[model samples]
Target: MDKCKVDVAIIGAGTAGMGAYRAARAHTENVVMIEGGPFGTTCARVGCMPSKLLIAAAEAAHDMKHAELFGVYPGDVRIDGKAVMERVRRERDRFVGFVLEAVESFPEKHRLKGHARFLDAHRLQVAENCEVEAGRIIIATGSRPNIPQMLKAAGDRLIVNDDVFSFDDLPDSVAVFGPGVIGLELGQALSRLGVRVRMFGASGGLGAIRDEKIRDYALQVFNEEFPLDPAASVSSVERTEEGVAVTFEDGDRGTVTETFEYLLAATGRRPNVDDLDLQNSDLELDDRGLPLFDRYTLQCGSSHIFMTGDANNDLPLLHEAADEGRIAGENAGRYPEVRAGSRRAPLAIVFTDPQIAVVGMNIQQAHDHCGGCFEVGEVSFEGQGRSRVLGKNKGLLRVYGERGSGLFLGAEMFGPAAEHLAHLLAWSVQNRMTVPDMLGMPYYHPVIEEGLRSALRDLNRRLLMGPESVERCLDCGPGA
Candidate 1:
């Protein structure tokens, strides 16, 4: 057997693994990245980029259909599903090429193409022939879409994100399982692109928004685009001549049966650690079969071993995975004594129409952390100037802050320009900004940001500082 030694051996070449590679390279060149195949990161290959492409196409089709609302008349608008999917694949391949080029650019000896299995804590065997002995190891093997066992028998009729974007043609109708981020985004986009879509979730909420009001608003907006059954609980899935038949209980509405040409399962994802031979290591695993690692240092039980990205099951987003990878890489290079890094405030978004963003703690989290001491301020877009002008004057925005101190805790919103607004709120929350600090910032007139400003002002009014605090600040001299 061929044997080699390296400072670090990183498994998987996705975002997390590449991130670790770059960071580790800064400290040591004795780092090798091993992969089985499919070189591109999840975002570039399937997750973010491809989904956005489909959403963009759907948005264009939706805009054309609504052109008459703006006093524009265009007749006989047609949508070519084949062309749309072709563009998605063409652009997706271009993105994937960048990653492949980067990986290929590395020294031939530094890149290994094979599956790696841990033979011991400090050693790994790749594809039975090659052996690698590393002082430290970083596991960045990402994740794969989780398809329930009950639906596995349906075979190709049940699809996941990995294969959904690469379809040669769009299905005539689909039953979307789970109304989380993937389901809502794709289900709505597919419906807008002229497909019959029915979305069903076991829970009442949509996406990860914990604010009940915002969730309700999201359901309302999503229902307008496609049928949503949030209370659905699947009982059985059976293959049918046409496609598949699903029987689910629709809380209060009783058991219902639906047939679709295809079923898209967006329930969740499982970490790609099952085949990593983790049992050979000294690290302890949780009930989910994920290694118990420090969230700050990304270090597994052993100081020389670390787990990052979706494999850790901490934060599965691409950006979060990258951050975790950096932490793991840096600490793994440091060895002996791991260094802890600060994690950013939680930020997540659902790219549905009018969008939905959850920043930091939501309503329930704030209540759980601070009890009744937190104050909530809300602004409805029903009469917002910019939203009315854009004919999207719906949804709501709510901000939570400490009642007495006026410190911003978190925010949840389902409204226009929510993606941008969420970023703004996330930054502020990460910095622990106060209501007064946010209110003092400039807000342009007749814009969606004004809605956020209004919510902050409402929150400020509820705080003990009130308007007097602003007056006091203004009364003081420039340098006071």
Candidate 2:
């Protein structure tokens, strides 16, 4: 068997693996990246980019339908499934092309093709032909869509988020399981695009929201558009020539049997570590069977093996994966002198209408992280002036802060412009800015941001810190 040695070796050339390769090259020239699958990232190929394309199409259709609320009537809206899928696939391929260009630019000598599994702490077997021995190894194989075995009963009728973008034409109806990020975003988008959708979640959760108030508000809004059962009582699933048959209780409608052209399983994702034979790596595994590692340093135990990105399963967002990959690579390049790398504040956004954002600590984590010395302040956008003016007045925003320190810790919001709002909150939390400090920032009147200021003012009052909100936003603010 052919064998090779390198200062550093990285497995899987997805977003995180690629980031690790670039970072490691800064410290050592003897680096190699092994990838068994396609070069494009999950985001470019299946996760973010393609999904957003579909959502964009849905948004256009939805806006035209709702324009009457503004006293401007648009005629009957008809969806072109073929054209929508074509654009989604075309644009998706374009984004994937960009990533491919980046990968192909690397010298051939630095790239290895084949799946790799651990032979030992310092060695790897690649596709049965070659073996790699390295001073340090970084695992960034990423993850795949996870489906429960029961869902497999749908057989050929079952699909996942990765399969959604590949449809040549939209299905007539779909039964979506899991109301998490993938299910909620795609389910809502599909519904808006004229597909009959029924979403069922075994867990009583919606999007990434943990706060009951925000989650319930989103749940109500979504159900108004499509049928959603956050806590479903599903009894059986079977497949037939037509599609999949699902039997479940539909609340007021009681038990109902529905047949859908497709059943989408968006339950969650599992790491790619299973095939790597981690048992041979001599690294301690966590309860999830992933290698135990330092969250800050990305080192697995005290060994030369390091894991990051979805492989570590800490936070699977694309940006988090990239950050962890760079940190792991930097530590691997330096070995014994490993140092912890800086990480950005936690932030998650779900792109459903009214959006959903969770920044820094969520409601579930506030007490644990803030020592139970936190308070919450909120505002309902139903009466917010900008929202009413835009005819998008609905949803809520809840901000959390420390009692005495009055620091802006985190927030969970389901409201208009939540994606933008979350970014500002994330920046503030990373800076450790207190609520009083945030209240001093500028607020342009008649904008959606005034809603944020109102919430901060309420938070300041509750905290008994920070100056009273500058008497502002009357002209174009809530109740204006």
Candidate 3:
């Protein structure tokens, strides 16, 4: 058995772990990273990147299918399922390769290959190969998909988002459970790619969208693409001779039975801290057994330990995970002089059609944060010039601002180019821009961003923040 002492030890080699490793190395060379799984980011292996590749293919197919709307009829659209899966796998491997290269570039002595669990507060046992005693620790072990026992009834037919990127060919049909980010994106991509898809959700929610208007608009828009019933009444799920069989309420059809090649469990993810034997440690833990750590510092209960990434369960997004890892690593490296890391405004985007983005606070969050002293500014893309011109005229956007300060609190949207718009709004929120300040920015003619300006104008007027328009008003050139 090999034994070593290090100043910092980081568990897991995903995005967060890598970031922590880099940050810790800056302060001292006495650092090591332990990972039991493959060296690659979740975004690269199974999360964002591969999913976007599939979505790109789906978008191509969808545009070709709808070309007739532009008076250019595409005679026949034949989807090569094998080809689609091939490209997804090929590009996915390339992305994973880059991550592997990064990990390999680190000193081989700094890498340990095994699952690590806490022996005590400062000791870690790495799969019988090595014993590590460190002054400080960072748990960036990441997360795995959470599957309920009910979905286990699908037996061998059950799969998760991680398994989708490795398909040899697209299945004929899929029954996707969970209307969250993974489910919505994969379900819509499959539906658009000529696969019969039925999506179900236990609760009435759409990804990170908390505003009721955007949620309902998203639900309606996506259902038109595939059968999605949030708050669904699912009777049973059983393994059939051919595939997985699911019996559920199908609107007016009233409880129908359907069988699909795969039953995707996109429910959610659980922190990977469970297998770490956290009970042996002196650190404080939540009821779920996860460590109670400071969000700003990623420090675990005033102890020498820290938690970051999905392991902490604070914010599961890759960017947030990276940020937390950096903070945790920096604090762990400097020990006893832990400082708060700069946290950016919240931003989330779902890459579905008419994409969904939530920046800063939602309506409920705004109201709670401001004690109901907030006003809403809204815009429907149905009448927006650019959206209508592009035949993508659907969805809604709502921006929230404080009533007194007129500060741009947040914005949520289900519309074309929402990902781009969300970035702009996220920057605005981070900069503490007011409604009038945002409106003062130049908006060019005949653009979707004019929709944002229109909403800002409404918010400014309602908050009495900006002077009224002087010339040919009409809310800036008919929604610009």
For 67-146, candidate 2 gives per-residue lDDT tens digits of 99888897889899999999999999999999999999999989999999998988999987999999999999999989
Off by over 4 Å in 1: 249-255, 468-480
lDDT of 1 by residue, 1-480 (tens): 999999999998999999898888888899999997679999999899999999999989988898888898888679999999999999999999998999888888889988998999989999879999999999998888888788776777888887878888887998888889999899999999889999888767688888888888778878887889788777888888878888887667798887899889998988899998999977888887788888999988655889999888787998899898898888877787688977898999888887888998899999988877999989888777778778777779999998777899999988888899999999999999999998888776567787787788778888767563433122222111
Give one clash count per candidate, in the order shown: 0, 1, 0
The pairs that clash in candidate 3 are: none
Q: Give Cα distance to truth, residue 69, candidate 2, Å.
A: 1.1
Please give each candidate's TM-score.
0.95, 0.98, 0.98
Candidate 3, 1-480: lDDT as tens digits: 899999999999999999999999999999999998888889999999999999999999999999999999988999999999999999999999999999999999999999999999999999988899999999999999999999999998999998898899999999999999999999999999999999998988878889998898888888788989889999999999989999998768897999999999999999998889999889888888888889999998889999999988888999998899899889999998999999999999999998999999999999999999999988898988888889988979999999888899999999999999999999999999988788778777678988888788777778976584522246544555
Q: lDDT for model 1, on a 0 to 1 scale?
A: 0.86
Candidate number that wins on lDDT, 1 or 2: 2
Q: In model 3, which regions exceed 4 Å deviation?
A: 469-477
